[model samples]
Target: MSDDEILMHEIDTQLPVADFSHSSPCSAANRVFVTLSGPNFRINNGFETDDMEKLYSGLSEKRSETKQNEFPLIYLIAPAETTFDQIRSAIRTAAKAGFADIFLVTKRTPASGNYLKHGLLLRLPTASGLSPPSIEPIFVRSDRDGSIFINTGPSQEALDHCREKRSLPKLNETLDNYAACARAGGFEPIAQIHIDSSATYQRAIDVMNAMQRCHIRHITFTDVTSTPHRTCQGMGKGKPGTPTQSPSAIPRPPQIVNPVKR
Candidate 1:
């Protein structure tokens, strides 16, 4: 099967069961992290025109609620060339709708395996050749044991859209509804990353460093985190420069306190 097909299948199998309802809601009272997956979908610049319009129009309504603290959406995709006007408009819509946070997923240094780093997620757009008008994106690393939760208000709305509910009249409206779900009854979102590759150790260290520099203050990897005994898509032998060792297989390199000679 094609990679997209596999990913779609996996997502289908992974999804939990739940009933749909306009009034009946889920939870969005807590903080969350959402990780997006699929075949580098984020980096692909030109989407079907219909899809792009549908996505943005949907985003507009969602943004309206974001200002009301009704729902929030976070992105997890590799950077790519994107139009500034479109991106800014989306952000504005999000702000107007009561949305708060928007995070990005960046490539691990030495790029290889399923390694991810948070805090540095924003840099990927630049790395990938796109820049938003003026927005800050939280970066998060995907390695070891990681999860992304999205329960703020529009949780149900997003879930419904993802499911492509037929009863919903307009695709654009779906975004706003989902934002409401996230804001109203937030649901937790998660995506685990564990792969055996030579560059794993270095990737982990880079992620940790980025986290520290960004002042994200609540990540841990000591006893609770370990390399899992499984493999994932796009996870095989790494490229050069990456130290060949799974995240848990080797010790992280020492951080340089000061490089310039006094």
Candidate 2:
């Protein structure tokens, strides 16, 4: 079989299963596939290694050959056993190498057809791209037990604030409170989610859904090491003075899945 055929075969066998709950299909053109197998990162199911520098180099070369203004879309295939930190690092490296668009590849269900042939794509923000000065980024972290914490800095006080808010089960309400506070201060809120190494993909999905429900779509996935130290914006500050509407009362974000190629 040809190289393309071989790569497709590898993706079919190794991609993870995720329920994006979107009906739109992803296109098959102008895209590159990267997979994480155990401890190694594989490019197009070919060059495989644990060294991130090599992976960055490979992605940079691919970036150089793409269209002048259009970077090739990246399809990342990581199994359930892979850590969110691993996935975050891969995405950060890809962005640093000049590839802007990236997606997490997964099947709609376990019994679904070959992922490459029939699967849903979850588009991830390329990196912490520049935002308006009027917008401030709020840091978020999710624990394995479905507890989520949010703060504006990486200091111990911020950490403690997150821990305090862990007992709160209403994620959507907590996030909405933050967004309202930021808006009240004339600053738009952007969320930079920090996914722990032990956190599962399902937890990440839950967090994403919560962000969507709160109308916070300008989200970025950040690695633990790159967290910034800013002034602590207390997590408890967003508690609404009056009763807030439920998440179901909000309109959903528009689905923008690319057209499928025949």
Candidate 3:
């Protein structure tokens, strides 16, 4: 059988259960199917292990075998219980292994209660591309409670914006304003999103969609360790260490930082 058919067969037998109720049907010719099994990840149902070093090594060898400049799309089949943090780590690992594009698989229904006939695809942010040197990337963090923090570095104006609107519905506006500001400063609008470990996959997707709507297409995922601070806080007024402003006032455009240098 051809490679695609072989892949479909593997997917049918090994892909983990995921909620595809809100996803739309889609297909791609160049793709690899992966199943997230707890601490270990399975690639195309042929390899399974919890050792990240081994996983990266294997993937790198496979990548080297492919034609130059060709990166396969990763279709990750994750169980419904998979947390956003796990998904993000998987994607990061794939990126390190020389893969770029990734898709989260979803299915409308299970056929015969045994296998999935087809899957709905959610195109994740490309795992490879880096923001251009000329553009300063803004950082966005999603809290466990689904609140968004937009940091543009020490900007009170940005902090005020976040304080006023931190919900997903207002995410578009928040990103748009940042994009506009970046453009005004002669830089491309790129956002680096960091998802909390407790956040949901749906929340990550929502943030991604919001970034796209604001024309901030150059996106990347960042780990918590990379950021200067985990959570954004307001410079409180009055008594020492007292935050006169509401906790919501903490979201703001952080000072522009060069991601390439970080």
Candidate 4:
């Protein structure tokens, strides 16, 4: 079997990636891209945590009626090997399903793994000349046993640029040194595995659904109070109070602070 077929069989037993697009025109738009990684021991297995803190950022902004059309684009970052074939398969599947974007970050392989040529799977579009709705691949470099550092967000452009300048021996040496340092002191093996793609994807979907519901509520409230006058008891009377709720009912700030400020 092909690598794609092998990965498909290894991960899911029920359906193919192509089957995901059949649900709705917006199904792909609601899909979340998740990256899986762990200690070398658990690298190929699943995660064991349900940490949703990173995934819930910016939810409120997109939860309003005016922005209901927008959905959350989730990118999971982990220190694993992101193969080119897997990246291509995901992009093709997501593109067909109408997703806005797909993203993943994995560890850079050593000279082995035949990843030099196949590594293009992780490369993102620096220009429109390549493809639409670009998929980002982040490659983290680690020493033989170092904990990996993953970059999955806006820095994709910088990494791609750096990768292009591979001829620089100085740059290559710096990365190697850093990886070695990380392996010596920073590497933390996972005691227990937790969160994985399916869990993260479900949380994303839930967040999107909640966002849509919140948007609907906002619209309903706006429409209820937008009227200047209401016909009540056979008399045209102006409503004094629109009966609106405070946006701060939950007492939340615009952003979260780490609290343990020095």
Candidate 5:
């Protein structure tokens, strides 16, 4: 069976009986991580197109007088080239429905990690082609910053391996980096670096050492995608490199506090 099929089947078997059932209107009464998943949407040149109403309908739960607190965290997937505006729209719609937070998957980083304003979950996107050791600064930054997601590549081969579990080119560098950093401050990187890879928990562990990372209280190993994990398609992702921001506005890398004289 195809990886997607397996995922859908799992969702069918595991989707909670109450997940789709109507519930009394709730407020921030209960803390819960809600999953909002969407499939197809139009993305090109960093723009995403979808029906806002439909997106909301998928997330809404009926309310009753006895209101309970519920904190919903929406997760959305982005096709290549999905833009910022579309993401904004998604977030806007979800807020109308009272979502507590949003988690997103996109090829590029957002305009800025300004997610806290809207309670958006943050992911740390590492630079491609650079070794993990070379990017230690970013890792340190991510750890210090708190609540970051790290995805390495949209590797086609990685996706293929998820389908068959066939012997494939392992992302050795990414793997090694995760191992080295997993112990630092008790944070671990995910094995299935990319969401495009299957989200079966076993598949992830089979690929990389996520057991420790998963155990880290400060870290989260997000693998809900491909598990039919609910996400608002094109909810919100910032444009890459903050292109519109002025040079002065962009953050500079941390400088060595005590560099020896040249």
Candidate 6:
């Protein structure tokens, strides 16, 4: 059986991940998982998650919509490749679904595109490009409302980034660190987990179980791969390409605060 097969099969196998359902906010709400394809989409294909599982572009959205409302809104978008069409579809699905919050697990920053006009744009801080999530970010974001409610999970590319960087922290350690950050901030902060994709199902299971243990009931899953050219870096809402200030210019700013724009 393939890794994706194992994942779906394991979903029904009473794994440690499943047992944590009572602990999860979403599970308690009892939302059925659904996947779909529609004319609105660009490529009309699913994802690597599906492809790896040999279930490409095929999704089961069987649950009744009436039953779905009882649970909090969460959508996992795993685009098949890093193509603009796939990226656009993922964004459109989330928006059209009208999900209150979304958990996007993509290698590319969704914010780097205009896809996220619904909520606040928070660019998480990292130690290395692949370091475990930083507390500095959430603590800063916590002051805002709708505080920590995980609506998404990370994708293979995210985990791959961690692996390439060679700083994959222990699953428990990463969770503990996040828990501490959330507690200290006195608010639940939104964030994604970068589990090692090489670890495959085990890594995913560990992350899920960890979330349960931590009472993080909400999350999403997606991998945005725009397998094409960059038409716009975040569709005009792109983050700072270069630092706003040089060391020499930093001391002089009270209002200007580094007027440089790249």
Model 6 scores worst on lDDT over the 10 consecutive residues at: 9-18
Between candidates 5 and 6, the one scoring higher on TM-score is: 6
lDDT (tens digit, per residue) of candidate 6 on 1-262? 1112111111111111101122113352433222323323212233323231123122222112324333333333332223333432333333223222223322224345643221211111111122222232211110011122222234211122242221223433545677677878785433333222223322233344445445543222222222211111111111222111111111111111111111
- TM-score per candidate, chains pooled: 0.23, 0.58, 0.56, 0.21, 0.27, 0.28
* lDDT for each residue of candidate 5 in 1-262, tens digit (9 for 90 to 100): 1122112112111111001101212244432333222433432123233566654554444211124343334444443233333543554454445453444433223453533232213222121232222122111101111111344335222212333342223443444455568666454232322222223322322222222222211121222444442222212221322111111111222221221110
Badly placed stretches (over 4 Å) of model 2 are 1-28, 106-132, 135-137, 144-146, 152-169, 180-187, 220-262
User: Candidate 3 — which residues are off by over 4 angstroms?
Assistant: 1-30, 106-136, 152-167, 184-186, 224-262
Question: What would the per-residue lDDT of candidate 1 be over residues 134-154, giving only the tens digit for each residue?
Answer: 211121222222221222224
User: Which portions of model 5 miss their true places by more than 4 Å?
Assistant: 1-52, 58-70, 73-177, 181-193, 197-262
> What would the per-residue lDDT of candidate 4 be over residues 225-254, giving only the tens digit for each residue?
122311100011212321211111121112
Extract clashing residue pairs from model 3: 151-254, 152-253, 152-254, 152-255, 153-253, 153-254, 153-255, 158-252, 159-252
Return model 6's CA RMSD, one decimal.
18.9
What candidate 1 gets wrong by more than 4 Å, as runs, is 1-54, 61-71, 80-90, 107-117, 120-262
Better of 3 and 4 by TM-score: 3
- For candidate 4, give the lDDT of residue 260: 13
Q: Tell me the spans in candidate 6 whose CA falls farther than 4 Å from its real position.
A: 1-61, 64-169, 195-199, 222-262
List, in order, the clash count of every candidate structure.
54, 0, 9, 7, 22, 21
Better of 4 and 5 by lDDT: 5
In order, the Cα lDDT scores of the candidates are: 0.26, 0.50, 0.48, 0.24, 0.29, 0.27
When 1 and 2 are scored with lDDT, the better candidate is 2
After TM-score superposition, the amount by which residue 87's alpha carbon in candidate 6 deviates from its true location, in angstroms, is: 19
- lDDT pick, better of 1 and 6: 6
